[model samples]
Target: MSPDSVLVRWLPVSAIAEADWPVLSALLPEDEQARAQRFHFRRDWESYTVAHALLRGTLTRLAAAAGHPVAPPDWRFSIGAHGKPEPILPEGVPPFRVNLSHTRGLAAVAVALDREVGVDVEWLDRTNLTIDLADRFFAPAECAQLVGLAPEAEKDALFAFWTLKEAYIKAVGMGLALPLGAFAYTLDPLSIAFDDRIQDDPDSWYFQRLRPTQGHVLGLALRHEAPERAMLDAAPAGLAALLRLAG
Candidate 1:
């Protein structure tokens, strides 16, 4: 892995067999396991389980790669002022920032060294993606760009704009307190413009959109690292393999 790379990883929830779920769930801390159990549907439970397990596994690998050597179960997390979960590392270890998102059948995580990073993945067939929703949540210019686009293309652009904005807010760690309309994004070249209400430099951030699978779209945002590009790990090892595999 290059020092300048942002490692992006995703795993399909369905890939983990029912029998293997307990093994993967075992990797999670007790609190996370309790949260997973709170989901009303088993599918949601599995998604949350795989997502956080993926996060811990990836963090273990990244921390060790940086010479800190923290085990998956031993890693601790603290929530930010908003609700973003942040890793707690030992003193003298360089700062490692991470963010993860999971939706329906997919889970994704992004990790960066000494830089803030946020990632979002959404299932493509969401029924709520509509112009009215865009008008309500997106910047005026962003919503305007969606107009006149073909139906399929419009959905693609909507998710692109949505995930990018989501990535930005998550990276900021302010959650919904930061209005989505305060900053606008443009496609083709992919850039952002901010309104007076928000204080951020567009140049200090980097954004990328990718289709990790045919059914999912992923967005990545990192701060203070313009030239740093995200590199997706092909896939996480199988659920059973995940436990025995060394970071």
Candidate 2:
């Protein structure tokens, strides 16, 4: 893969065959198996298995490309302070950052060359989410913009802001430790700015807001090493093409 490459992978979580469970379960580490066992609901357990299986499959494919690779089931991970997961790579392997998000029936993962990557996929039904909560977490300008939307348009805008905010914090690898109100994003130009406190420049990231299917909305963010006019344009054709497979 080139430096500009990004791979967006999505798998359907709601549908899994009973026969496949054993195969998928074999890919999970024992610790992950224990955590999956703790889920009281079988559906939740299967979902957890599928998501982690896909993630591990991704890492395994990364290693396997060299022609002599370890099995995907042998991979292990360590979670950081803010709850981001990192793969334990063997020597001579190129390490990559990852962020994963999953909803009831869908899971999405964004893997990039050598940069911090964050991805969030929200089930867009909106009946379970409320604009009222935006006031508590959204920046003032973001809230004002949400308020100005027509009554029918408010739900969509609320989700757009929520996913963008979530993706940003995930990229920072601090979860909510980074203040939500410390940054603002504009939908008009698809740009972002940080309140004086955050030193990172907004220009250092490439963000994509995509709706791969009617039921889900996705936010993908990649932290770039340097600013470039063609960063978005230079992404390999297969990158955007991969997103289409998300549905």
Candidate 3:
């Protein structure tokens, strides 16, 4: 992978063999393991556990591929002020940025050599996604667009707008401090329009949308100094297979 490219890896939680769960879960740190145990339901536990483990595996492989050679359990991270995770590296290792998202059945991680990157994935059949919810969380123009979408297409459109907005906030590292309605996105050409609240240049950012699976929508946001478009190296498969392929 080139330094300028973004590597994305996703896992279908159900596809992971039952016996492999312990192997993957062991890759997580104590804090992550404790958090996973806090979940009340089995499915939530599985999603939380797999998402974090996949992130560790992805970063470990990425760092080693760059010749730094960190083990999956050895990578360290510190959360930024607004809650985005930042990798902590040794002096000679090149810096990289990462963001991750997980939905009901899937988990995804995105890594960029030296650029801010964010990723989000949503299971398409999310319930109660209505125009009212869009109006409450989306920009004015975005709400209007949702209102105009056909009933059959409305849910998908809402999820698209949602993932893009989420990717932007995660990339900016501001979390909810960057209001959802403060930024708007148009799907046709996948461009963004920012309101007064956000202090950003639309041109410096790049966005990509993907259907990692027929039931999921994924969005990626990246910030680059040059006009060169980002190269995406995405592996939409099980984590165990991805680890071998990336190696």
Native-referenced Cα lDDT, model 2 = 0.73
Task: Write out the backbone clash pairs for model 1.
Answer: none
Query: lDDT for every model?
Result: 0.82, 0.73, 0.83
Residues 79-175, candidate 3: write the lDDT tens digits: 9998899789865567878898899999999988888999999998888766788878899888877776688788778888888888989998988
Among these predictions, the greatest TM-score belongs to 3
TM-score versus the correct structure, for each prediction: 0.92, 0.86, 0.93
In model 1, how many backbone clashes occur? 0
What are the per-residue Cα lDDT tens digits for candidate 1 across 18-70?
77787788788888899989999988998888888888888776667778777
Candidate 2, residues 1-247, lDDT tens digits: the string is: 5577667777665445566667777777788889989999876787687777777777666666755476666777778899988777777667666677877666677777678888888888747567778888888888888866787588777878888888888888889989889998888777788999799989887787777567888787788855452143211122222222222
Best-to-worst TM-score order? 3, 1, 2
Q: How far off is model 1, as Cα RMSD? A: 2.2
